[model samples]
Target: MRKKIVAGNWKMNLSLEEAQSLHSEINDALETSEFNCEVYHFVPSIYLSTLLESDQKVNVGSQNGYPAKNGAFTGEVSMSQLSGIGTKAVLIGHSERRQLFNESDILLKEKVDAALEEDLKVFFCCGETLEERESGQYKQTVIKQLKNSLFHLPSKEFAKIVIAYEPIWAIGTGKTASPEQANEMHKSIREAIEHAYTQEIAQNTSILYGGSCKPSNATELLNQSDIDGGLIGGASLKSEDFLKIIATYN
Candidate 1:
């Protein structure tokens, strides 16, 4: 089965104390609940070690890491560093990281290469802005982004990655894609993978919808044919909403 997964991207929002509290709450819920989907919680880099020290029932990953394994780069965490700290995954090419830090596709591809070399699973993100969508370029835009950064990997390496389709416009605007819209994009992504690798790979890969996902809309959104799960943003900060979303999928 394609493992249905929900990953919470805690984006620069929690302190060490807050991280511990939220992690505890989430782990408690996961431990007590009977759900089949994998739950991965990603936190800011600074708290990775602190998050790992706890006995976590759910998976924990870093939000980002430097492309290099190790170097003279001061102030940047490398994939090796992440592995040493027990982080099993990393988010590559998140829209915020692309826009705010000017991370080009080339740069992100480098990050993906480095992370995979260290055997870290990747949550690779791709989507279009409102303008691109309005201009009818969203489909091609997303495909091109995938090709540039991800299609280069061999099927084995690609199999270890999760694709997150987060419509940039809907991400924090409280707007969401109708189920049809989300499924449409997800189908396109799956087709792209099929074109790059094989039909089996496309069918088995998990594609997550990540724009403003909440419990109220998650069911309808996830009910679509191709969307495997969610990459939750704000709702993930609250254990109740996040667990509710999982229960819906359950």
Candidate 2:
């Protein structure tokens, strides 16, 4: 079956103590959750050890990582190191990384390759900017991103990936892609995967919608045929709202 996941991207927000407290809160909520899906906390790199050491019920991952193993890259964490630290997953090509860090499709492909090589699940994020959407190139833009960075993987390696379609226009802007809009892109993503791999791979792939997905709109977005779950952002920092979003699947 396709994976159903709600991954909270706690991007560079919480300190170690703060992350620990939030993780504890989520753990307590999960005790009564009964939601039939996977949950992941994509915590900041410094807090990964602290966060994972406290919680074992839900999954945990890093927000980003370097493609190399161990090297002199001053501020980078390697995929092997992340895996060794018990990180079950890692986010590759999040828009912030691509935008702020200036990560290219070539660089992202290297990151994806390293993550999979180390047996880590990759939450590969791909999306279009506001201008691209306004110019009606959203579909083509996203497809090209996937093809250049992820589609080159062997089908088997690709299976370890979960695609999160986060339209740059909506993320953190409080603007959301209407359910129809999100589903349309999700269908296109799945179709692109099918064209590159196989029907079974496309059918089993978990394509998440990551644009302003909060409790208010998660239910409607998830109810669409192609959207599996969310790569939640700000709302995830709030314990109550995070639980509410996860509970939508139940």
Candidate 3:
């Protein structure tokens, strides 16, 4: 069975102290819950070690990592560094990175290769612009992104990857893709994977729904056959809400 994963992308939010407090709160809550899903938090690089040191059941992930193993590239975090700090996964090619940092598919592919080379799992994000969705090219857009940025890897390495589908229109806009809408896209994504790889890989890979996922709609969203879990945003900051979302699988 595909593993259910709920990953929090704490994007550029929270200070060191605030992150510590939130981590502690989340750890406390998780201990009291019976949820069996794998939970992860993608905090800033600075808080990775701090969170890893905690007794939290949550896995630590990097918001971003460089494509290089070691280089003179300033301001870039390498895969080796992230692995050394106990990062189990890294979020690559998030919508924000594509919009603000101009991260391209070529760069994202390199990052994925680097991460996998270090044995770290990858949360590979792919989605469409609002215009593309309105024009009915959402599936094509996502397919192109996945093919270019990820499918190049071997099937053995592919097993370590998780795909997150985040509609750009809904990311932080408070407008979520309805459960039906999300499932349609997720099913299409899974089909794309089956076409690119094998049906076995497609069925085994976990596809997560991102874009403002919260407690209010998590149960419905996660209950879908193709929707394995969530790549949460704003809702993940609160301990109660995060736990509630996790409870959906229970």
- Could you list the CA RMSD of all candidates, in the order they appear? 0.8, 0.8, 0.9
TM-scores for every candidate against the unseen true structure:
0.98, 0.98, 0.98
Task: Provide the overall lDDT of each model, using Cα atoms, as 2-decimal numbers.
Answer: 0.93, 0.92, 0.92
By lDDT, is 1 or 3 better?
1
* Model 2 Cα shift for residue 183 (angstroms): 0.1
Give the per-residue lDDT of model 3 (tens digit) for 145-241: 9999989988999989999999999999999999999999999999999998999999999999998899889989999989999999999888889
Scanning candidate 2 in windows of ten residues, the lowest lDDT window is 49-58
Q: Point out where model 2 deviates above 4 Å.
A: none
Tens digit of lDDT per residue, candidate 2, span 160-204? Answer: 999999999998999999999999999999999999999999999
Task: Report the candidate with higher lDDT, 1 versus 2.
Answer: 1
Q: What are the per-model numbers of colliding residue pairs?
A: 0, 0, 0
List runs of model 1 lying over 4 Å from the truth. Answer: none
Model 1, 1-250: lDDT tens per residue? 7889999999989888888899999898888878878999999988888888878787999999998777899999999999888899999999999999999999999999999999999999999999999999999999999999999999999999999999999988999999999999999999999999999999999999999999999999987999999999999999999998988767
- Model 3 lowest lDDT segment of ten: 27-36
Query: What value of lDDT does candidate 3 attain over all alpha carbons?
Result: 0.92
